[model samples]
Target: MLKKTRVAVFVSGGGSNLEALLQSEVSGGMPFGEIALVVSNTQGAYALERANNHGVEGVCIPSRGNSGFEEELQALLMARHIDIIVLAGFLAILSADFVGKWPERIINIHPSLIPSFCGKGFYGLKVHEAALERGVTLTGATVHLVNEIPDGGRILLQKAVEIRPDDTAKTLQQRVMEQAEWVLLPQATAQLCQELSEKLSEGV
Candidate 1:
């Protein structure tokens, strides 16, 4: 069997994206990769529960208001031999040291087409609100590499969802997830993992 690329998903909320990824992995929809770990910065996050239900190891490593959180997180990821890190609603800003250590190995899924309703302070419902405020006919989700800056990375994939006239921020959020985010995230993950696996086979 080909060696599967191990992925660690980080989250700070309910982890619906993580759930999609897990389902994809088990259904053989996400070829070349497996979810090895789920990490949450907040103990109250329900994402951790979803991870356990999926039979994946999940842990809570609170930030504790310091850089120590990154150190502990790094150790845990390394111990699990994680190859890719996906930020699925993870709220903490990654330190420069952590970004440097991971480089392009880290990625995130944003609620809107990046550079549109994205950047710092554009997450969760705020992104959809911004799109609605701007009266854009179409808004969608983006999967991109995670960098030192928030939501300012090379775009890997994007899928658009039309903004209905009657949509509220909450409704728009659900539409984006169902129509775009859920679809693009797993596709991007599989694409990235396949590329990584091929590169490894080539000894690159």
Candidate 2:
């Protein structure tokens, strides 16, 4: 039997994206991938609760004011044999050293197209608010590789969402997730997992 790629989802918020990935796994959308762990930097994040409900191991490793945060995080990931790391609403900035270790193995879901309302200080409703303020008729979600640069990684997939005239920042945010982010993230993850599994088989 072929080995499944172990996946770790990192989250800092409500983890709606994480939930989508979990659902996809159970529905057999991600045939080569299995969600092995869910890690949150915030102690009380609801994402942890979702992980618990799914019977996946959930861990909290606070990054704030912790000098050895990355070391500890890397250790936990290694122990779990995580093959792919997905950042789903995870707010902490990974150091270049840590990012280099993962190379193309780390993936992140951003709320907007790259070189737009992305990069530093742009996350959550802020990206949507900027899109509305700029009067762009179209904005979307992007699933990309995670590099040291925030949201600057190579794009794997993107799905556009229309900006409605009556859309507030919060409303626009919800629409983007439902119409684009949730869809693209799982698809991209499954693609990566399949590619990785094939590569591993080739080497065997």
Candidate 3:
């Protein structure tokens, strides 16, 4: 049997996107990927619970006030032989040093399309708020390679969602997740996993 790529999902708060990825693993949407570990910067994050429910290992590294945060995180990823890292609503900004170590091995899901309501200070419902405030008729999600620049990496996939007339920030956020983020994240992860599996098979 071919080996499955080991994946680590980093999350903060609710981890709705992590839930989608976990579901995909079982449903064959991500056949070449195995969610080997879930790491959260916040202790007691609900995402850890979601990982546990699916029988995947989850840990908390506690980024707040911890200078060794990335060091500890890197050690854990190495110990588990993590092949890819997925940032699903993880709030902390990773240092360039840590990001350099991963190169294109890390991916992140942004709430809005790049060069739109993305970059620093736009996260969670705030991205949706900006789009609504700007009166954009269409806003969507983007899954892209994680780089030192926030949401500046090469795009992998994007799906557009229409902004309804009655949509508030909260409502728009939910719709984007349901219609775009949930769909694109899993597809992109699977694509990377398949590519990585191929590279590994060739001993690259």
Candidate 4:
């Protein structure tokens, strides 16, 4: 049997996808994973609340003036023996120091198909509004390796949602979230797990 991967999820929102990941892993009868830690950059983030409710240990690493962000983040991951990192709705651009340290070990779920309506200032409902204004028939999510600057990395997987004629930013955002939490989130984590597995098997 393959050993379960110890994954750490970082979030800055309601952590709906984190909830989805936990649910899927528990019910899927799969024995290849566990969420070791859920870290939040903001003290008030609801993701932390979710983590607390689930009894998974949670930590808050403040980005305030860069006091100890990298040190604290690295320490937490190391202490957790984290094998994978997932960024779910985490808005801050992680430091190059951190990304360089982790490389492809980190993943982010972007709110658009990427290269279409992604990058700095295109997060959250802003992305939905941009897609709608551009009249694109499709707008969705992209899960990719995290790099310095927003959306600045290789594309891993993308799944799209249709832009209806009556789409408001809120309406479109709802669809994007649904696509994210229900499908892309779990699939992305699984894909990363497979990639890491292959990387190990190749070296054997």
- How does each model score on lDDT? 0.91, 0.94, 0.95, 0.82
Clashing pairs in 3: none
Angstrom error at residue 132, model 4 = 1.5
The model with the greatest lDDT is: 3
- TM-score against native, each model: 0.96, 0.98, 0.98, 0.91
lDDT per residue (tens digit) for residues 128-186 in model 2: 99999999999999999999898989999988899999999999999999999899999
Relative to the true structure, candidate 3 reaches a TM of 0.98
Give candidate 1's error at residue 87 in angstroms. 0.7
Q: What lDDT is reached at residue 149 by model 4?
A: 65
What value does the lDDT take at residue 180 in candidate 3? 95
Q: Model 1: per-residue lDDT, tens digit, 1-204? A: 456789999999899999999988988988899899999999789999999999999999998576589999999999999999999989898987899898889999999987898888888999988899999999999999988888888999998899999999999999999999899899899988888888777778
Off by over 4 Å in 4: 198-204
Candidate 2: misplaced stretches above 4 Å? none
- Which sections of candidate 1 miss by over 4 Å? none
**Winning candidate number (TM-score):** 3
Worst 10 residues of 2 by lDDT: 195-204
